[model samples]
Target: MRKYGIADTTFSRVDMGKIAYKIIRDEDDEAEIIRYTVPGIKDLPVAAKRLIDEGCDGVITLGWVGKTMLDKYSYLATSIGLIIVQILTSKHVIDVTIHEDEADSEEKLKEIAIDRTSKHARNLVKLVKEGKNALTKYAGKGLRQGFRDAGEID
Candidate 1:
């Protein structure tokens, strides 16, 4: 395996190397970094909590939000679901990655999914900063469900 290094930092391919490096230099000493990797859409809340319990400062979730070839059953819900789960976990998360792909065409089908996912991701981050679980109400429902709750900004 190829080993990559920066200054005195060295990383092995099989490790969460870059993240570990960042965590070490993170300004927030109270922060914990959590990464979630899954094969399918399942038990998102449980996954989020496990990372939080493990002292995760944030979460980077990897999974197939939708398949590019499939236009019908595949949708952005898988990505949106995990984000909502993070809302209920705690307010300690510093960042979250839903691992989605950009749309390939300008057709309505692709536009809808891409737009919804982008909007939800942005809103979820905002709600998280506000310390609220407003997005959880639409968990498992996908981006088409329009799950967003932005409370008063103070």
Candidate 2:
């Protein structure tokens, strides 16, 4: 009965969209999933907004940033834009971003992408099905998608 949207960028080196879509499909069977593929990170905000306008309860935006000053600026802009879209639509827009420099090797990059996208997709399912309270238990628990949790502070 619920509708969810996935907005991904083709600029990513890894196929994060596919991973996310698969995870969502496997995790939630009752919800409807709609996906939009864009050319770059900067384009994700609009895509996500459109999906929300089309009646999605939430949207997951996936993007990859390069190891450059320009890329960093672009990422910041994209992030801000996503926030704006969320505000305008009064919907949840989960931003999942990976920086190319985060991993030293291609294998590591792929691993990070898979882990991050999969986890976020599951989170999306939780959010749409159970609402924000489902995630409140994780507050201050030091959670990380691509890597291990930082653990709770004593």
Candidate 3:
């Protein structure tokens, strides 16, 4: 009976899960948006599938991973997120990504962390209310083309 889905894990930069919940429960006017946040990406695909099964119109992901892995596994993690979004999109699910900077040490990182977090969070709330946005608005279409998911999204 819900219109949207939320999924996420814990990270240092920003609380993507928390933000998603606030957007869905507080900002969103839709009476049937179902919000959920878990410990990590482990629950993402299952959650996405569940949304699809439940007839959710869209999905939002909020999660964080260290930017230290940028040269390492970050690509893989991003790829996985993209694949899930794509799969869900192919099935007609509206996807959105709200990228959050998890790099807490770098000065620019910190600034971006705070700035993007606020911007994304506030924008998310506004978008949810208007029911007119998706993650592809930031991360591009090929990699993300369905509901909204914030990978390291604060």
Best candidate, TM-score? 2
**Clash list (residue pairs), candidate 2:** none
- Model 2: how large is the Cα RMSD against the reference? 0.9
Model 3: residues with Cα > 4 Å off, grouped in runs? 11-13, 25-27, 67-75, 88-154
lDDT per residue (tens digit) for residues 16-89 in model 1? 22333353334233333333543344444456557656655344332224334452123345345555655776
- Candidate no. 2 TM-score: 0.97
- State which candidate has the highest lDDT: 2
What's the number of clashes in each of the models? 3, 0, 16
Q: Give lDDT tens digits, candidate 2, residues 1-154.
A: 8999999988998988888888888888877889999999999999999999999999999999999999999999999999999899888999999999998998998899999999999998899889979899899999999999889998
For model 1 the TM-score comes to: 0.34
lDDT for predicted candidate 2 compared with the true structure? 0.92
| Candidate 2 wrong stretches, greater than 4 Å | none
Identify the superior model by TM-score, candidate 1 or candidate 3.
Answer: 3
The residue ranges of model 1 lying beyond 4 angstroms of the native Cα positions read 1-36, 40-45, 55-57, 62-75, 90-154
lDDT of 3: 0.50
In candidate 3, what are the lDDT values of residues 1-154, reduced to their tens digit? 3365655555434564454556556655553666566555445656666765776655555444544546226535654764766575654332233343433355555444444444444444544445555444654322211223345533
